[model samples]
Target: MKLKLYADRMSQPVRAVIIFCKKNGIDFEEIRVDIAKRQNLTPEYAEINPMKQLPAIVDGRFKLFESHAILVYLASSFPGVADHWYPADVFKRSKIHSVLDWHHSNLRRGPTTIVRNTVLAPVLGRPLNPEAAAEGEKFLSASLSKIESVWLKGNGRFLLGGNQPSIADLSLVCDIMQLELLGETERNRLLGPYKEVQQWIENTRNATNPHFDEVHKILMKAKEKLQNPRMKGATNEGGGSDMKRTLHSRI
Candidate 1:
């Protein structure tokens, strides 16, 4: 059996995983799980991911969930995946892990919460919460400042002085991309202050193009769809090439 990826590009982490697989030329099939439709909450998906998350995977009999875990698994398991993503060097891998862990509480929390409260609330059947958005902005601003002062200051195109983009780079950038749904003026206001962070976003995108752009088309589509009050719901489809082959991978 070929590896099966359960995902939806509307998700930030899901987009990261998809871009990683594409950049590494990993062969697999993507099974899209529509959150708006609540497909991920169904019993069938529960067996694959008890947490009922947007991105999960089945590699032969082994099942995995959580975007960062999946990225590390793929980077280490797949023959096609390059070592730079999750390097074998014990120290380097640990450093990368630190960034990934730091992301959830800092960078990921901000943008995800803000996006949900602002534009994404209506689609998710949620109410706008300016209180939560205000809090989220605090985290977002702090996260950006940390990135500028600590990570980007190293004079590398990617995070942690990596010449090439790593799994951490992809993961964090995808989270920031959620800002694309905001109006240009608002988006610029938030991101414009951090010149290095802005440039890092571009660098990561350049490192993994066409696929990065392809996977993120949903953001633009959603932005457009949200403008039309008449639309009830939008379609949630998988992104990436079919590119299937027989499954054989490590843990």
Candidate 2:
């Protein structure tokens, strides 16, 4: 069965899933959804994902959403590669699941909100409110401290009880990459306080993942485009004027 993934190139969760597929040698097709254009919100996309979120998938006739769920599904679907990435032991499996759940509720939201407010919004020619940016920074910094304490408590290079990478590492890597793309100033501010977290981020980035280069290239382009003022408004769909209005109104 051919797998089809609906994703935004800049979305960290999407990249995380893509990296998993690449590392496991899973064959799939990517269908880009331009969130800046509100493409995900359109009825056509809503039919596939009612929440209008990126990184949804269709494996043959079966449809799925949520990056973590997709990761578990992919691992179980290909058991040959499961032992290391998604262990079979009950306790080990539970540990992985716990971290993933925490990722969804905590780690994932902090850096993402900060990057969107401080980096993506301004690059898209949308004015960033100073107060919101400061709040995002505060939230993200606190989250990083917790992540360092929880995951980096041991001297292990990988998360959980393993020498090799697992679903926990993959999920965390995706979230960490968002902070890395936030320019030097913001990236340092977010990552500097947590020494262990910084080292883990580097380890994950250097690890072997089939989609590493492809995902990295996309992120690099996004960072570059966002930093260039002259190109911001012209590059985005509808010049991002409508998105700016929508985001600001929500704030």
Candidate 3:
């Protein structure tokens, strides 16, 4: 069965699947959803993903949501392609899974919230409260510190017990890419103090992931567009406007 990915091209979760597929040489067709237009709330997308989230997939009769779930499904489905990506060893596999869980609760939400509140909202001509931005930065800083501590305790080439890329790396890399794409200054600020984290990010960027360069280019372009007043209205496609709306709606 041909795999169908429902996602926004510029979304980090979507990019994660793209990078995962590229690295494993798995071919999948992409169905782009413009989140800025609130396309995710439409009944059509709602049927595929009740959560109305991007990076969901349909594989024949099976459908899945959440990037980490998609990664595990893809890895297990295409056996012998990259064993190290999702090792068979029980302990190692558990470790990778643990990090993936931590990612969703801790690292992932913090910086993403910060980026949306501080950068994307202003670009969309929405009000950006400094107090909320400060809160986001605080959360992001705490998450980064946790990541630094974990890296310091481990072997450091990849997350868990591998010298090569693993599911842990893929999960972390996608979120870090989102943080970096917020802007150069914010990127440097978040990554500068964590040398190991910085190195790990660099390694993933240089790895054999086919969509790595493409993802980076898209993010960079998004950042540039967010910074330009003239391109403000035009930059709301993909996850930009939705993210902004979510951020403000929360406040």
Cα-based lDDT for every prediction: 0.81, 0.75, 0.74
Q: On residues 120-220, what C-alpha lDDT tens digit does candidate 1 reach at each position?
A: 66545468999999898999999999998887768689899989888999999999998876656777989999999999999999999989999988777
- Which consecutive 10 residues in model 3 have the weakest lDDT in total? 242-251
Candidate 3 lDDT over 1-251, as tens digits, reads 77999977667778878888877888888887778678888999999999998889999998899899999999999745578888788987888888888887777777667777777666567787677767767777777787767743577576653578887787777777777546677678777888877877777777754468875576776667555546545655535554455433322
Q: Which has the better TM-score: candidate 1, or candidate 2?
A: 1
Off by over 4 Å in 3: 230-251
The residue-by-residue lDDT of candidate 2 on 140-244, one tens digit each, is 776777777776677688786367788888888777777755777767766777888777776776775446766767667556555554655776544555445
**lDDT of the structure predicted as candidate 2:** 0.75
**Model 2: pairs clashing at backbone N, Cα or C within 3 Å:** none
The local lDDT score (0 to 100) that residue 64 gets in candidate 1 is 91
lDDT of candidate 1 at residue 5, scale 0 to 100: 93
Q: What's the true lDDT of residue 23 in model 2?
A: 81
Better of 2 and 3 by lDDT: 2
Write down the TM-score of every candidate: 0.88, 0.86, 0.86
- Higher-lDDT candidate among 1 and 2? 1
